[model samples]
Target: MLDGLIISIDAMGGDDAPDVVIKGLEYFLKTTGKQRKARFLLHGDQAAINTLLAKAPLTKARSEIRHSDSSIEMDAKPSQALRRGKGSSMWNAIQSVKSGEAEIVVSAGNTGALMAMSMMILKRKQGVQRPALAASWPNEGGTSVVLDVGANVDADAGQLTEFAVLGEAFYRALYKTDRPRVSLLNVGTEDQKGNAVIKAAHERLSESQLGLNYIGYVEGSDISLGGAEVIVTDGFTGNIALKTAEGTAKLVGRYMKDALQGSWWSKFTAFLNMRALLALKKRIDPSGFNGAVFLGLNGVVIKSHGGTDAKGYANAVNIAIGLAESDFLQTIDVTLEALHDEDDNIGFIK
Candidate 1:
């Protein structure tokens, strides 16, 4: 078996905290049947967790509890929480990962709070200017990794290029892509089109010796079509693109359902097409793409949707475990170091 993978979960993080989080843990343990190898550090009220466990006992006794009486509110300023809420569940969970008690940390808490706590506790990797939130979105061919999903809203071209390098390393480690294609999200596909920042980033990415297949610029529509395996952008644009895609998917799904049920003949056709529809749904299910990994952090930190349900929360925890077991962070560090060295050598040669 892979080395022990400990996932630190903020039991009081999400909208349906404690209950949903507990249920998710139970579900994962029962379904995976590897509860012994995969353990959890549930950070919250010991009494509350014990009460829940008593009602619904876990099969494995590997799970541990770290008591935290307080919870950081979703709206609370992340910096303030990092400074003041040291005893909160979110802080404690990240701390466990930072201290090496846990290999990965998963939280369905305040995104800002988790990001802040991770930056403060685990710290950024060497040579990383800023940590970024990287998430995978389902596409036609496969999943695509989008970096700075909500981490650094204001980023320069150099930072965007760094994101590209980080993303390429992540995909290489996890997805095993030979040379991951990296693209900068832009309004137009042309190399000369976009603001000064985009043009500068395009030039840097084109000229950089990162060994990635920098595929020029890609538009928002390319996201769903798998235009590039790794797409890099500032958090502001990335967030807007991600939310727009999600909303469009929802709208299309609803519209199709409504149109199909409008008449008896259409309803009959819908019944006939149910299998195909289900297949499409499975392809685009958000739960399958739940966790947003915080790359460039010293420790693995997964940010789940604040409104995630039991299944969604469980998926995030599972992702964290898989990433830790896969040793993605260490592999990313090594790959980035090699890229940096190559870049430095080229500079020296010139």
Candidate 2:
């Protein structure tokens, strides 16, 4: 039976599928600590998921299994998965969103396959030349929205402007921010530093009366310095920056751990400052922002980290719920129509 808000889940898509998925759902229900009326349509191998659900009373109560023996592999190519992914857990989860059986879909499956299937199934929202993936980035001020993070490797001027639109709406939806500052990522903040595509996109944003807080260009260092609330770029550059930041966080964590345990004095100081250390850890933890959204889609789909724990998965689920409850899609549609109208007036779309 359908309940309050239905979330479709690819239960067998993650690295620790079924087990982690069930535990994550349980954590989401328990931690919310309110009268949440959310239910789940879990698509996966019923036998495996049932075994886990037997232990997770909260999740079992809220989730229903849509049995599918097949699942997409972590390393499977998008093309291959597309050819043979029918009836798979990932496929069914997306299908639920397409068929209006669920408000949103969550998957920790192969990114390529997930994006491919989402595009094929849900298609693109009107006025969108191409869809972009947006990620929640932890920064000095707070979380910033960065796109197109590995969705479209190369975006032209028009597509880059579209990313700005998509990212602005996304930042608002996720963080409840009003009038998020949008900026283009480039080598330098100066107008002449970027290539032709970047310059063209910048010109368009600056001239458009789309009501965006279109700030100028921001460099890599500015990303963590809260240079702008929404940083827009091509997927090639954005993906590299994302990976580099992730790796650097891990490296810093390792270094901190080593220094904290190097000697008795270090250990004593670490113990004495345990509270601050934990606060710092929580601030930098990637799991706190685990959901990557494939924006500009007809339906909402969240891509959770494959290796994330229960906490990370819960964060993703929370994002899905928040979007489901908001008028995010309508806002996007209205803004996109404005952008298209403006573009058409100046022959920008041509």
Candidate 3:
């Protein structure tokens, strides 16, 4: 459907390496069952990959394996790995995309390494100052997008505004929202509460005709409660908000489970409400929304957690396929190009 989408997967990038990664791919192929058509280029040790496949039911017919001799360790410096580990799985995967061998690249690898290799190899789109990592999280309402999660820790008002534009485009394309509500993440909801950068971004958003419903400001609590569909902020604030939300979710889930199991009456209630409880769990499950999409890159790049196992890796692969099928890259590119033109027009008017 997508002209035979090629996904370059770093087989040795995640915590489980080739074993779980390959298993995930196998599961995806079995479950989807001709509903989607795509090829994968698995990059890793050829011998190891073969050995893993030997024990499993996967044949080499559906996908090809590209051998890479080395791997970029999670602890290795991102810049150093990008400079020296030219033949590493991560580097080779990105190179495949750059060389037109692949339409998208997905990895459950080191975040810093993936970001560094992506910025160096695929590079950013034209007029994109810096690429941001936009991740979707399940909120009280449904889901929301948060940008610049950890890509550029220190960003200016222009950068934040760019994130907003990129985020709006992503939401429109993926969620099909008519007018995605964009909000600036801040400590206070007031316009004048944050520092100079935020204030400037608020002003620019208000004055620009970018076709986005730019909500003035949003507090941290608004994230989980779904105050806005698209939240834009610098990497520092965005990363903090993301980690805090994840940690809080885990804590709350654990506490609730423990409290419910503490007494017989509570256990009886839990049994009676098991269906509702399971529904709630599915709503708040982190694994359901595990893929983190790196926006503004020339191609689609999804970064999954290093701690992901077979199921998590499978989820990431599914997300990659969905993105490719949706033609997310082209959608974002066209939207951003329009927004850039609008910004240029505003500049000329002033």
Best by lDDT: 2
Evaluated at residue 208, the lDDT of candidate 2 is 92
Tens digit per residue, CA lDDT, model 3, 116-156: 99988898998788999988888878779998898988888
Off by over 4 Å in 2: 33-35
CA lDDT, every prediction?
0.82, 0.91, 0.83
Candidate numbers sorted by lDDT from highest down: 2, 3, 1
Comparing candidate 2 with candidate 3, which one achieves the higher TM-score? 2
Which candidate ranks first by TM-score, i.e. highest? 2
- Arrange candidates, best TM-score first: 2, 3, 1
TM-score of each: 0.91, 0.98, 0.91
CA RMSD (A), model 3: 2.7
lDDT of 2 by residue, 43-120 (tens): 999998999999999888888999997999999999999999999999999999999999999998899999999999
Where is the poorest 10-residue window by lDDT in model 1?
Answer: 341-350
> How much does each candidate deviate from the true structure in C-alpha RMSD?
3.0, 1.1, 2.7
Clashes of each: 0, 0, 0
**Tens-digit lDDT track of model 1 for 255-344:** 877998999999999899999988977776787788899998898888988887767777787777777777577767876787667657
Scored by lDDT, model 1 comes in at 0.82
